[model samples]
Target: MVTILNEQAEVDVTPLPRGGDGLWLSHADMTRATGFELKSEGLCRGEICVPVPKGRHDFARDDAIDIAGFWRYLGHPVAHDASRSVWALGTGAGTRRQALASLEAPDFTLPDLDGRPHALSDYRGRKVFLVSWASW
Candidate 1:
């Protein structure tokens, strides 16, 4: 999800419904929903085209995008009031963020190659190291 810090608090965003004529989404939702696509390619869901920076599609793990700038470019608004000190993300039509369908982590219990039940959280307080190699 998109994370932003303002004078008052932090804001988290989630995805919105389809068929709505606006651009409103969380960072995670935007990444997944938009298939990790950025603006320059102009290929987006719902047949929408936005003009993004030339190399935005090549974003790396450490890269950051200005959410407010992106929103404004996509016809959305990053709204804020001096009194509230809160920033409200708005779609073109004044739509607010959507309710998250589920926030629970995915079930990851599974058996390893040796048929042993492996629970990720089992090592919560311990240090674990994973190593992998390819013979290619």
Candidate 2:
């Protein structure tokens, strides 16, 4: 399960559900999970070895492989099952690999709990560690 953002910007990648069964993802979730620095190369913000395809279309079909398209043609399903509505794609044609790229933390300004604008870039040149916890 990969969460993509901007389509032109790099993605942020992180593990799902504290070692749970399924991979859960969202645009904001990806950025916070991965770390800042979005690119098309599909590598972590600081590390190398991630792989993303170069072309936008399948070439054979001339259809674009935008996030949703990739999910469907690969045999995955996007559905609403009463409990949840999920959009999931397969790893690949036949490989068991999980993701094509790691998520990159995104940078943006949004209102905080107090309605003040929070700019992610404000932390530039500083090391920031963000941890996400949930009680369900």
Candidate 3:
């Protein structure tokens, strides 16, 4: 089984014919890992659709899709620790650029000292002072 780390979730899917850097998953596993369904139009998640390259054998074979290869084809970042069987996928550069173009910070929720949940949106419309420290 391989664990895929996406923006909002971590999904585990068994990889078929396990070898090489490519992460091949079945149709159901693909959807479970990436929320994308292989369609005649390409990979579609809701209204968003990404056209699969024509004659690209590296992307799909025998009902399995190489998600890592497909993500690379879309110019997205993919990081993997094969020993750990974990992969992390990042948003494409274009998506990051568009997000950066918007000055507003994305909303996120975190627990406070008392284990109370606090969301960034909760402090919206007011100046928020944030201090973060992490031991690397």
TM-score of each: 0.32, 0.26, 0.76
What digit string (tens of lDDT, one per residue) describes model 1 on residues 69-128?
Answer: 555665655665553233455556432222223533322466778988877577667665
Pairs of residues at least 3 apart in sequence or in different chains that clash in candidate 1? 2-27
Q: By lDDT, who's the top model here?
A: 3
Candidate 2 regions off by >4 Å? Answer: 1-70, 74-77, 81-111, 115-119, 134-136
In model 3, the runs with Cα more than 4 Å from the true position are: 18-20, 113-118, 129-131
In model 2, state the lDDT of residue 35: 42
In angstroms, the error of model 2 at 126 is: 1.0
The better-scoring model by lDDT among 1 and 3 is: 3
**Candidate 3 residue-wise lDDT, 24-126, digit = tens:** 8998999999889989988999998887666665787757888998888778999998484999988898877877689778677888789898899999889
Score each candidate by Cα lDDT.
0.47, 0.42, 0.85
lDDT of 1: 0.47
Worst 10 residues of 1 by lDDT: 95-104
Weakest 10 consecutive residues of candidate 2 by summed lDDT: 57-66
